[model samples]
Target: MISTKIPFVIFKSFFNGSIRIKLDWESLISEQVTINMSFFEELENPSSWYLPWYLNDVDEEVSYLAPNARQLTLADIPKAINHLNSKRRDKIQELLSRFINSTQPVQLVIATYALPDGKHLIMDGNHRSSALILAGVKARLMVFEMFGPLDPELLPDLRLWKD
Candidate 1:
């Protein structure tokens, strides 16, 4: 839950300015209450990276995208939940409990970056990252840290960290 200060974020619209919303900076965004993706699994584009300061190298960036944020379509959350990664399925199931336990609004960061194909990328708020595709949540054009032109094919996958 957020108690410190209101933060800014970024958003990439699939239809309107809502689809994939993201946060900026690592500390501003809380650790995922749950992680649905396995170290070896492939994920949808529009992933996330966090840091104390904006860093261009993937090795220096922190945080990974959450599974709940990767739903392909935004028509229904119920349907998307079913497709969440299998390894951390139990962890994600606990999100509802977290919501029930607290009434405070959880803090999220919005990040905007440029992908290799010239498409813009939004990083942050895994919960709402796909909300636009799932629940049609509206956004206020959140602020973000923008990363210019990154190579999707060159970016490292989660497995790359398995030293």
Candidate 2:
């Protein structure tokens, strides 16, 4: 677990709706492997935007609540590729195989955004996360990028770019 010894009152405010989130920006930069959720979405589906930075930018001032550091195994996470087409699935599988053969550690990127329901939404890295699951690896390091105050009701309207 990645514990910074955050106070209980902070957690309380986060869930009580007083605070939007509890994000650690330091970790994201130090890791140098964060997936920009906003950018990923903009790339997947072109949308009208005022600026290029807006394409991938996340608001730093917005606070969010996320777990200290989760030491998760395969059973801990949901299947990341359920929504993907066969072609994408296969490509991911190939990558997974390569990963298995390599000496490098399997570090997965996870983007955590606050949902109105108070649960963190796991975005991106489905393929890599799923690969970790399939390999039956326990305790992989998952880097998190946090966003939100997003309405849970809007979840239905949201979809990952799979094309």
Candidate 3:
């Protein structure tokens, strides 16, 4: 049910003048998309919310690692969007309508699995990322590197991208 076995820690590093955060957590079980949604409540005003607020009810001992932030560009969006299913694609379209012409900078929590081929399998943030892409808005991504048993078959609508 996505319980953590240890306290989460955030590590910061400087790479080429940019800050990179590395988060390390243990024992996260990937679940179906709908089930995963229960872990975080939707914010009424997206701009007012930060990633940590979503985990307010989650036990501190089991926290998701927060890595440093990086810029998400237009070139990266299409590749990532290709990984989502039609259902998620529709949601992104919905969000696009609202986010279009939005000047507020977008920041997102992106979770991924590092693959052998150097690509990342996006385990979370498909909707937000997709919408941001459609709106032609660049974003700062706080990437969470997920380490555990992740079955793609369980989440048919995940996106894949190279960072």
Q: Pick by lDDT: which candidate is best?
A: 3
lDDT of 3 by residue, 1-163 (tens): 1222221233112111222222222222223111111112221223222221111122111123222222233344454344434565578778887777567766666554444443444445546755765676555556554343333333221211122
Worst 10 residues of 1 by lDDT: 33-42
Rank all candidate structures by their TM-score, best first, as comma-separated numbers. Answer: 3, 2, 1
**Using alpha carbons, what is the TM-score of model 2?**
0.40
Q: What does the lDDT read for residue 118 in candidate 2?
A: 31
Candidate 2: Cα lDDT at 102: 57
Cα lDDT for residue 17, model 1? 41
Q: What is each predicted model's overall lDDT from 0 to 1?
A: 0.32, 0.36, 0.39
Prediction RMSDs, each to the true structure: 14.8, 15.9, 16.5
- In candidate 3, residue 158 scores what lDDT? 21
Model 3 has an lDDT value of: 0.39
lDDT of 2 by residue, 82-148 (tens): 4345665686688678667757555554444433333344444445555655554433454343433
Query: On a 0 to 1 TM-score scale, where does candidate 1 land against the true structure?
Result: 0.33
Model 3: CA > 4 A from native: 1-86, 147-163
